[model samples]
Target chain A: MTETSHAIRIEDRDDPRIAAYRDVRERDLIGRQGCFIAEGEVVLRVLLGGARFDLDSILIAANRLDGLQPLLASVPRHVPVYAAASPVMDAVVGFHIHRGILAVGRIGAPLMADDLLTSLPPRALVLALVGIANHDNMGGIFRNAAAFGVNAVFLDDTSCDPLYRKAVRVSVGGCLKIPFARIGSAEVLVDALAAHGVAAYALSPSGTTDLSDLVPAAQSALLLGAEGPGLPHEVLQRAHTVRISMADGFDSLNVATSSGIALHALRAKSFPLT
Target chain B: MTETSHAIRIEDRDDPRIAAYRDVRERDLIGRQGCFIAEGEVVLRVLLGGARFDLDSILIAANRLDGLQPLLASVPRHVPVYAAASPVMDAVVGFHIHRGILAVGRIGAPLMADDLLTSLPPRALVLALVGIANHDNMGGIFRNAAAFGVNAVFLDDTSCDPLYRKAVRVSVGGCLKIPFARIGSAEVLVDALAAHGVAAYALSPSGTTDLSDLVPAAQSALLLGAEGPGLPHEVLQRAHTVRISMADGFDSLNVATSSGIALHALRAKSFPLT
Candidate 1:
């Protein structure tokens, strides 16, 4: 088969051009400079479709190339697409490239929290997360945000990076599409949301208001925390506390599931799904 | 610290009493005769609270014994509690027993599908699952079912066993608390639900009615399928179809997240938070 115009075949695992794809598990993705790994075809497509992140190069198994032509055509020619046989691909990444597609993406300067808040339209739904350390939960939240039309997400410094590989895959590539920022602190986040006229609600089992009873404002933010050690008392006190009323003795819902339910309940009244 | 009456300290991994707790990962939990592994302190507490499943025995690390007194006291005197040093505990389970709590639970015969269905009160909500094979997803659905005050859960034989170890832990031990039955097939389950006058709603991306527009009857069932191959087309045809309206060009939400959202929506009109 004739290779696509953007294809660059690499026969050796030691090739210097493919350095970024090596020993991925050892790399500290959260603190790494500029580049992020987008695994699987769905996530790679999401990475390419958006303007916020740019393609650096892609390393894929030889057989996966033909099926991805339609998606690959959109990648600028300058963004090299490296094709390798399955064994070489596995050796480079230290694991089987089961999905047979991997991409090196260059992320631009993160959107500033204040700038992102100002950029929102008059009515917007924002998910403000505090201390959400689990990668899967982080990914699931981004997915829920995207599904229900949340304008953007603001993650506290304590939260894990959305671009982390597992989170990206678990989100089904949602982390690539949703707009997000690592804002400094939960206090600053709540204050900023209040200043922007967004009604911020902290979710907790002891929340004063029932989620069913509280009406959403024109602009709203749903505040969430990690599983066991929930939101700090100060953060909870800063925002209006709302609880997903449940059976009396059960622990609170998982953070991701809670977010989806809350987002669905508070979806814009005029959004028309109903 | 001195030991409690039920505590039996075991210094050797070869002890025959710890046989059920050994090399647990290698065992097939689904096809196993009558036993299920319940890990973590929370799940152990949940297991002890319920009467349907009886405790075979418990294995704990030496340090964890002091904190578990109240719960340990509740265990029947007939059931033995084995305390092992941390290393021996690790060797016995073939991994670090980090939470240091493991209980061998004996499941009674599965609740009959017709008996469970007929046992529901005048007004009830049920979550019926089809083809949910992932352990994490199975655990999650049980967690959500518990949170939203669902009366009972019915899983088709095609679904993974909810009592699998990972499912039990992921459910935060919800699998222990929630009354669940493994019924024969989607067809038989749907027919039984219809006979009981429960409105069964099969959830899918392509559906006739929006989830927001769904009106729950006196008794309701939300039918969910595995993520990629949603409910079998015939199953969707058999029950009224409903979808969570989402943004354009986006994939569907995670199966567990979808269940939480759909359950919350239907829960509002008919059920009250316990």
Candidate 2:
């Protein structure tokens, strides 16, 4: 745990000293495998505070190392810390850099849907996403889900990966904290939820049943669709279609925004004001 | 009233046949001057159905003209109709498109905050945005505002214009349906709301009061800031601070998503359940 084992300095972008940080954009397009990048001090601090993942390395511009010294000092002495000039760091990352601090961390192995469900308490809330490809929406949903006390999130096959850089960044690192599982399909999840006696609610603008009337159950799953096509007819049929009433003449709200509203409304009944 | 006065067909993208559809992205960035574009059939229909704005022209792909014949038949004979081949239309619009239709409408004169406030009914709900420059967020806020029965919206000096193409498109034409005004600053708007005897509620993650307590105000103005920086300290101090209670350890919701949840929570009190 000496200084030689903990810190490395690089002056060149292609120095192989920081191979983990190269081709970030291209890697992102292909789904960043093995590891995900956490940007900004706040997000990295959150990750460091949580036990969900192992940090691989820390990267900071040499000019900014003094500012992050206290944070670096707190990490395990064995963790590798790398510093580069600002321009070299930016060239390696393939984007104009602003946050100055970054962390490369190993993505933990995926969890099974059953494991996620079983880990929750009896009165648990979960999000079931369908066809939500937008990374921002996926991230926002996770952030909302965590804020509203949702026990876990289950992404249907069609949804985007929550660990994607943009999703993780947009989630403000909530993706790392929240327990999420990716299932093969909505049909399989619906059957599993039914077997577990969890009431499933499909969020639909055209739903006949008012969402407010449905009491929050001990275990409930909220299903959401993409912005445009909405939940497929079969998926809606499998769920108890519930609508958050809107003022007449307005179209449906954005899927992620609607998910936030729904989570807030549904979660309120279960979690009383503290 | 003749066919010649209404429908015009052009085979070339540069024929000057659809000047209204040219440089739409540039116009959006430059404040759109005197016009706004509504793309897709659904958005165009929403605009046509709403009484908030006047239509300047309608453009349909030549191959899809039959689909809109009924709508064309219903419109006033004075409005011009333009048709072009799908390729020509895409070239003119500077993007690949769908729904084979578009509409160009003159921008309505901006509404005055005082006028809109005076016209609002007792117990009216309104959204007051401060320093939210993201166009998509602006549009999403308007859509949420419209959906949750918010009577009007007031934008502070720092917000982007909601009429910009991306905003308008993201709003799904709700920007046209909702009444909105731009005020000079949050301070001025806070004072004005106080003068009108409306309760001003500033939404923040660190708010001292729960949002549920502020819903019963006879007239309320919900103040929101952009994501990250939140409401300016001065603005937060001037308005009653209210927070949407969240599960511990989670960060704040997305600004637009938070607005939706806040509006829905506040509006739920007045929702008529059958």
Candidate 3:
């Protein structure tokens, strides 16, 4: 049942209250007034269940409000919860949203990278992404970071924004839960990690150390670069470089997949028998 | 330089010789008379470099033919090589093919599950997927399977076709390289593994053993299920169930990311110090 305080019925596609959700599927509608769209029922649940960010509004198919009372009740009373017909939503979003749930929230601002590093626990696992332009890989890396108990993520200047709609969707709302800061170039990231007393392991095909052979330090950071042109030479030279061995003829694993394996490899070493 | 023998120019979007390439971007052009389209430069390179399947034809934007001489020269003389102007190629493919290289290849028949299992080496790593309907997950898993030196992969009947164009694209041609066969049900898959003296590890959140604690066997298989429902109860009962531990409140990892981590974890154990 739609809550009396929550239900703001939207009959037309162009309803101004739900305007942010319109044409969402045409391309990424990220960073519209420092806000990002959280799509699907699961991601919306993440938004409503947490207080990490201010929820601006939510829009859903009118028919789905029946069993979602508890979920909807969590939405702040001030947040306009818009309900529209599925067809109206489809028309507005420019794509059929099978999940029929959407929410908009401010991303706030990226925290100071140095402050984020300083705030970590003594024994922490951090993910540092360098030159990761693809939203899919960026999202997957964040999902891995959250899963493996990463203390923080520091993205280099060249990496794509994790708040991008596709990235947030791909991360399964991990981009919401995890604390991330975008910093300067790869060289600056390496220097910061060193300054923070964090042992850095830069992953690349040409790395000097095998992933299995490297033991995790009390404070560790796994550095992942974009797929083709991997970590900059200066960055790789500064960190304790490592590589995941593959089958004889195989060249490389997908960057996102590689990070998952690499993060787990380090995470297992640090948290064995936990 | 476009190889002299390979310079078969396609003038019109409706060319009969290139009919299968038409509207390829609209949806998957897989299983057209037992054929599949291998798109992009990297994947096409994978197909031409290997002979696992016969190439039916090759198509490219004429502009890209200059630097691809060696790649095109390797195409068998008997194979039809077609080239078109970028616009014409764009019109036929329905979506803009930014990579501008495509190939049609025969999938042949999927190998018999029993035969594929029988052919594995004595000490082998294999992957088994169940009810993985999503093409992206299917592709990512195959990429992991190939990277970890999994001797073979087996998919249950309920899973989607890996040769579907999107899956192939996602796998980065791991689907074309690694041998895979579709078996019956999850139960039947378990039975086959048992018969082959392969120790099966089924990943589930509710599994009895933590992933970090599991030791791989000489003949081991990692079984993965779809994201939400995970492995069926019957299948879990039949295998050594394992779970990748997460942070306190996190629920799950992406299926493909989970497989990469799981496969690598097991691979690290089976081939320790390799």
Which candidate comes out best when scored by lDDT?
1
Interface RMSD of 3: 2.5
Please give, for residues B1-274, the per-residue lDDT of candidate 2 as tens digits: 2233356987778877587787666666665558888887667877778548788888878877776776767666777888878898888888766777888888878789999999988768888999999988898888887777678998889998888887888888778888899889878878888888888889998898887666457888889999889999988988889998898766778888988888888777653322
Better of 2 and 3 by DockQ: 3
Pairs that clash in candidate 1: none
Whole-model lDDT values for every prediction = 0.86, 0.81, 0.84
User: lDDT at A257 for candidate 1?
Assistant: 96
TM-score of each: 0.96, 0.92, 0.94
Which is the better candidate, 1 or 3, if ranked by TM-score? 1
Which numbered prediction scores highest in TM-score against the true structure?
A: 1
Residue A99 error, candidate 2, Å: 2.2
Which residue pairs does candidate 2 place in steric collision?
Answer: none
lDDT tens per residue, model 2, A193-274: 7877888989998886877677767888999999879988888888889999888866788888988888888767664534
Candidate 1's iRMSD: 2.2
Q: What's candidate 2's i-RMS value?
A: 2.6
**Which portions of model 3 miss their true places by more than 4 Å?**
A1-5, A26-31, A271-274, B1-3, B26-30, B272-274
Local accuracy of candidate 3 as per-residue lDDT tens digits, B191-263: 9999989899999988889888898788888899999999899999899999988866665899998988888
Query: How much is the lDDT of residue B189 in candidate 2?
Result: 79
Collision count for each candidate, in order:
0, 0, 1
